[model samples]
Target: MTSADRLWPFLCPSHPDHDDQSLNPVAADAPSLVNLECSRVLVCVAENDLLKERGWLYYQELGRRGWIGVVEIQETQGEDHGFHLYALGNEKAQDMIKRLAAFFNREMPPLL
Candidate 1:
């Protein structure tokens, strides 16, 4: 297997029925919490990360459904998936860290 396949587990482990072709399947068939609710959502996604795109979508869906008070998306340019871990000392990683800190420090909307 290629490096990407080898690293898939660390990035996002595959589920037992992930191979099934379903658009909006039951929560039990998916890897997400049922009736999940959070006061704030901080999403850090690498711009060049394919895996993170799905996470971005999930957060967007939460925002659309008004389930999250805040949604933050940090797109780290010139970095791939797991850049923070693999691209330590890189400018992109440093920028991502700064953005994360800023997001955490900012005031969030009151929980609904």
Candidate 2:
């Protein structure tokens, strides 16, 4: 088996080189800032050497407007972007899922 096949089974279970394309148009616009007014917003960002450099700026912009409801940063020390997806059995991904679940539960409780 190839290394990517062995490492990231979910990303490309059958073909390691397959391209999966998905986009969020709303998240790509400047006016997308209004979307953060929700009761809670979970931002899962990795501490990639390059990506992490933008974290502070993102945090500052989001925090300054007081529009964000919740912010979570995953610090993957010595790791690069897309580590969670690459590391199939990564603890950070699991933890992030759990945290997101909790946040949704708290923010959007079930109807009585």
Give the winner by TM-score: 1
Give the alpha carbon lDDT tens digit for every residue of 1-112 in model 2: 4333344446556543322221221233345443554554455566554435445545555656555455555565656666666775778766666766787677453222
The C-alpha RMSD of each candidate to the native structure, in angstroms, is: 5.2, 9.0
**Which parts of model 1 have CA positions greater than 4 angstroms off?**
1-14, 19-37
Model number with the top lDDT: 1
Q: Which tens-of-lDDT digit does each residue in 1-112 have in candidate 1?
A: 4443455455455533232213222233544433456556677777677656555766677655545465666767766778887776988777778877787788766655
| CA lDDT of each prediction against the hidden true structure | 0.60, 0.51
User: For candidate 1, what is the lDDT?
Assistant: 0.60
- Report the poorest 10 consecutive residues by lDDT, candidate 1: 17-26
TM-score of each: 0.63, 0.50
